[model samples]
Target: MTETLDPEDAKIITLARSVRARNGSTEGAAVRDETGRTYAASGVDLPSLQLTAVQVAVAMAVTSGAKALEATALVTEADGPAEQDLSVMEDLHNGTLLLAGPDGSLKGRHV
Candidate 1:
């Protein structure tokens, strides 16, 4: 269920929503690195490439030298974060994962 998000968590959620709207994508995600940096991305689907929004955000964090995540926010119409999305995030570190509706309302949270 929805919890009161601290400013940091709210920031990522906002970023995720902005990306989803701007990209016209079904899913958009943002993650905060342990270093306080944030990365945002939308789902990618091409003939030769496919990645969930969370995956792309995680990749961006890693590519930027993020060793662990502080938190993650995903905004979409889906029921919840996908299984693969959970796996990839756990691979880095155990952090809060927030799932929000397209309207920016929190649907669920996993820790």
Candidate 2:
């Protein structure tokens, strides 16, 4: 992980962690739109429908009419984001992806 993190990115990390804790989910993600609005979500794991936190966050942005994203943060136990999650970010915008551990410590990053 980078030694220094942008303040906005840090906020997303915190937001993602909060979502994870509140929902008691395995993962959580937060995304910032071009306009600076942020969205946070925990993984959706219903029997009939399943989606990663990043996927849900991206969908929320799109449904809210956000044309592009500025950055994304994911709090997960896994080492990094899944390929499908990264693809969703790529589809909307080429932005930084921050990965954080359950304790909310930065673990890695992809730009």
- Identify the candidate with maximal lDDT: 1
How do all models score by TM-score? 0.96, 0.95
Q: In candidate 2, how many Å is residue 4 off?
A: 2.1
TM-score of 1: 0.96
lDDT of 2 by residue, 1-111 (tens): 547888999999999999999999999999999999999999888899999999999999999999988999999999889999999999997688999998989999888
Across 1-111, the per-residue lDDT of candidate 1 in tens digits comes to 657989999999999999999999999999999999999999999999999999999999999999999899999998988999999989998599989998888998989
Q: What global local distance difference test value does model 1 have?
A: 0.94
Per-candidate Cα lDDT values, in order, are 0.94, 0.93
Model 2 spans > 4 angstroms off: none
Candidate 1, residue 57: CA error in Å?
0.3
lDDT of 1 at 76: 91
lDDT of 1 at 97: 93
Worst 10 residues of 2 by lDDT: 1-10
Model 2 residue 62 lDDT?
94
